[model samples]
Target: MTKHFTMGGTATFDFIELLGGYIVAMTGDFDGGAFARVVGEPRVQGNKTYLDMEHTFIRKDGSTIQTRDQSVLTAVEGEARLLGATTYNVVKTTGAFEGLTGQFRSWGSVDPATGQGVLRFWGSIGEASAKAA
Candidate 1:
């Protein structure tokens, strides 16, 4: 059996928009290092918006882990917040993170006027071979 590991951290980034999506760069203890880029595509509904985001976690050693996240953005007290789920796949890992797969959940909110936000994510990670046959 593979060992289970939990990871999470806090980060801040600017909510930069581009081409129907947003490109965010984050710092401050993201998993192991910083999340270099987060590309988000949004689909809006009446009062809620759905976001498809790609998160790149770059470790201090330059290794990386890539995750696909799905989130719902809703208004809370007139501010925007996101709650979502994530998937970590072996195919998306680089260097030291290879052969690992897992799932995670994330939540955060942004300040529209300043275009800055704080984000957090936490979840368990395990080796791909741990899956049952």
Candidate 2:
């Protein structure tokens, strides 16, 4: 049997000069605080620019649910010609359990007037088996 868990969180991005990347730290009420660091290389593939990223997440409670994630980000035009949206395809791998893998999709767009962006993502785990399982 497969058991599923869903979590929603907000992240803050900090640019690191030495590393030449952004460090994202996210915290949520649902399961305490979770931290993730992402590093990426930017490349222009054809007409679109792409970011190849590698990241990891660890829970504050010292649980073994740490995961290594890879994501690709792309830009798109919204219904209005002036509006733009960004989308991501995220893949994750973890050792917390046997066959622990997850795939997630997310999208973000800024409110033109306020300049604030909203990001949302959902993830699903597949055929996971923990020691307890």
- Best candidate per lDDT, number? 1
Residue 131 alpha-carbon offset, candidate 2, angstroms:
18
lDDT by residue (tens digit), candidate 2, 21-104:
445455553243333334465565543454444444454554334444544444445532112222323345344433555554
Clashing pairs in 1: none
- 85-130, model 1: which lDDT tens digit per residue? 3443323777666666777665677665656667776666767674
Report the lDDT of model 2 for residue 39.
Answer: 46
Q: lDDT, candidate 2, residue 58?
A: 52
* Candidate 1, superposed: residue stretches over 4 Å from native: 1-4, 16-41, 80-91, 130-133
Q: Among all windows of ten consecutive residues in candidate 2, which has the lowest summed lDDT?
A: 80-89
For residue 61, what is the lDDT in candidate 1? 74
Return the top candidate by TM-score.
Answer: 1
- Would you give me the overall lDDT of model 1? 0.59
TM-score of each: 0.69, 0.52
